[model samples]
Target: MPKRYIVEVDGVPPSPSPISNAVVVGNQCWISGQLSVGDDGAYVPGSAREEASRAFAHVFRIAEAAGFSRSDIVYVDLAFIDLADVKEVNGLFGELFPEGRRPARTVYQAAKLPFGGRIKVQAVAPR
Candidate 1:
């Protein structure tokens, strides 16, 4: 049997709890829930719109590190603490995928997230 390799990326944020930022198995890379952590690893305060953009950017970084691109994303799971931010996340989604190609997505309202994050996004990309 071929050895299936698993990859992990951590230290993306100061999660009050333990979690993996991403995990790669075989030819697929699974990114964990991404919040609004910037390249400097700081969470900026703003509307969910701005936060989602930053979160997506952070997600792409993890994808890149896993040797994948945004175009190769196959699925995404999103969470929001409030439904009112749906429009904001949708608008940011438009800006992120202006080419009209987006991965299969599922978004839901959650009661809470690690580190008090308002939104989190998980992604799966071909590796």
Candidate 2:
């Protein structure tokens, strides 16, 4: 059996949800869903693309804390509050993955997200 460890970030209190901030099992790191909520618990708002950037930034921070770099990322899952933002979201993704070696990605629209956030992102990477 592989051991799964939690990677907790500094300053942010424990999550109110069931997931750890991030988890590392063996050679794999799995980051929990991340939103644009600031440390102060405020949601940052902008065009969907901007919000998507913010969300990915948050997930990237978690990946860093888990000792994984963006290059190690192998998969990504994104959920949007509205389907209308697909193109904008993909644009931001392109900016992040300009070399076209983006991790396997899945994007879908959800009715809502915590803190009324417009988008949430989760990532899987090598530990």
Considering every candidate listed, which one attains the maximal lDDT? 2
User: Alpha carbon lDDT of residue 51, candidate 1?
Assistant: 78
Off by over 4 Å in 1: 1-3, 6-11, 14-17, 38-42
Encode model 1's per-residue lDDT on 38-70: one tens digit a residue: 546566767898878777877887788778898
Report the C-alpha lDDT of model 2 over 7-124, residue by residue, as the tens digit. Answer: 9887443456776888899999988888776677577777888777877887777888888888788899999889888887888887787676689989898988987888888999
- Report every candidate's CA lDDT: 0.76, 0.82
Worst 10 residues of 1 by lDDT: 2-11
- In model 2, state the lDDT of residue 91: 80
Estimate candidate 1's alpha-carbon lDDT, on a 0 to 1 scale: 0.76
Task: Tell me the spans in candidate 2 whose CA falls farther than 4 Å from its real position.
Answer: 11-14
TM-score attained by model 2: 0.89
Please give the lDDT score for candidate 2: 0.82
Predicted structure with the largest TM-score when compared to the true one: 2
